[model samples]
Target: MAASGRRTGRPTLEEVAARAGVGRGTVSRVINGSPRVSEQARTAVQRAVAELGYVPNRAARALAGSRTDAVALVIPETEARLFTEPYFLDIVRGVSGELAEADKQLLLTLIRDDKERQRFEQYLAAQRVDGVLLVSVHRDDPLPDRVRMLGLPAVLNGRRSEAEPVAFVDSDNVGAGRSAVAHLAGRGRRRIATVTGP
Candidate 1:
């Protein structure tokens, strides 16, 4: 793995496949969880990978599967509130447990303003993350568009619209809202009111 040409500019799996005398699919299957490969093919692929000093890009691998080996959770919240937000904490815990079952890493980023978000976009564009899970997206945020434009696989947490169309994981916000109102009614809190806004 310690080669001169591998100076941060990693070779593609195609290079490994070429060296191994296998198709890209075979290489991919080997990288993934496929056990259908022959012993000879497996040895060849492994040797070629070792010889070429190839590294698979996580972002590319993320696209091939529904879940990635690494996911960046973008929090567009104040650092103060990020710690206090109980729901965010619960979501993070669940995400951590689920990802640990698959042996993945979690990257956390907190962006509170435009300047920081712009800088964060550059980091995201560098392909350091396999997938992104953006949280607390506001209506006028530019970052969602930035993530979408990069063609990276992304899943927004708590916010998405069909018109914009993004993969996301969210609690039943509307249902919870209704439940809150019902609870208030059950308590006999007459002249009740609720405020809803983005």
Candidate 2:
């Protein structure tokens, strides 16, 4: 405890409770915006919080509620590729915009090798994120299954196969190709050759 009779570190929930002349649970309820708290108690907690300059500890609150309020967007690619490739950049922009609207933090991770993949698995095991968004997955990548096994919600940008068990979002390559060809044919281009990916 400090000489002021409060804890030595940052002002804790108990200190706020003491200042507000309310129980610890009442302080918590008021801080969490619980509707059950009476107007008078809420006003007291707010006043105490402002007077003491108390800021809620996010890490402690996450541990208590089992919610980090953060989402990890894992892209297994090199930094060069992530920056150079317009597709990856577009994905990042779209995901960031949506996550911002939803009030969630986005953790962008790039796994370039087996070693990094293993390290990411360990990080997931620690339950540090609320959910995961996996992009640019390979056919044999094991991360999708590993994320599922950890019991965390996950969504893949694309699927490995038609029978992919994980939830995914993918573009219509065939439809896009057909549309492109039709556009060229409409412009009276006879010889239409398409280049496909490896």
Candidate 3:
């Protein structure tokens, strides 16, 4: 088929191959900038690509170069917790937006209990994702330590404690709470109680 005929969506490699009068491997080599392909084949493939207005899939290209271009967003919460709390949803939204800009995919995994946690650890060991983002990990959770030992690029939403080894992002809960209490006191609400969360 002609290059213009397949312009409705992203043009595939086969269309480029047919247009270039070469095989799929030759087109792949040309796209990957391999020197093994002949100059004639490369030029033909390039012209075909230009004519087709072909844009290479970043994820496929990354995989061709031995990279996944995927990040795992690990949430250590039960199904009930995930639905009841808006925090996880907020994190997923922000992460998804940012990752889309970067042309990466997010693999969300919720490790509710020890069994799931162990299974996830095994999956990580297989190098499924390029990096990890851990959310709501408590001190007792072994995920942080296990992820660290795997030498994966991992970031936590909050630190397990004051001396967390891995990278983490923490909100100023203390400052926010203090400001709230002061505001309440100013309104003559003396019987205020501060409730902490897990």
| Best first by TM-score, ranked | 2, 3, 1
Question: Where does candidate 2 clash, by residue pair?
Answer: none
Tens-place lDDT per residue, model 1, 1-198, is 357644355777878898899999999888775899988888899898888777777766777664456778888898788889897888788877887897789888899888999888998787767778887887677787789888888888756565667777778878998899899989998777778765
lDDT of 2: 0.92
In candidate 2, position 93 carries an lDDT of 96
* TM-score on alpha carbons, each prediction: 0.60, 0.77, 0.69
**Tens digits of lDDT, candidate 2, 1-198:** 768865677888998999999999999988777899999999999999999889998788888889897899999999999999999999999999999998778899999999999999999999989999999999999999999999999999989999999999989988998999999999999999977689
Each prediction's Cα lDDT score? 0.80, 0.92, 0.89
> Can you give the lDDT of residue 145 in candidate 2?
96
Worst 10-residue lDDT window, candidate 3: 1-10
Candidate 3 lDDT tens digits, 23-99:
99999989877899999999999999999888888778877786778999998888888878787788889999999
Best by lDDT: 2
- TM-score, cand. 2: 0.77
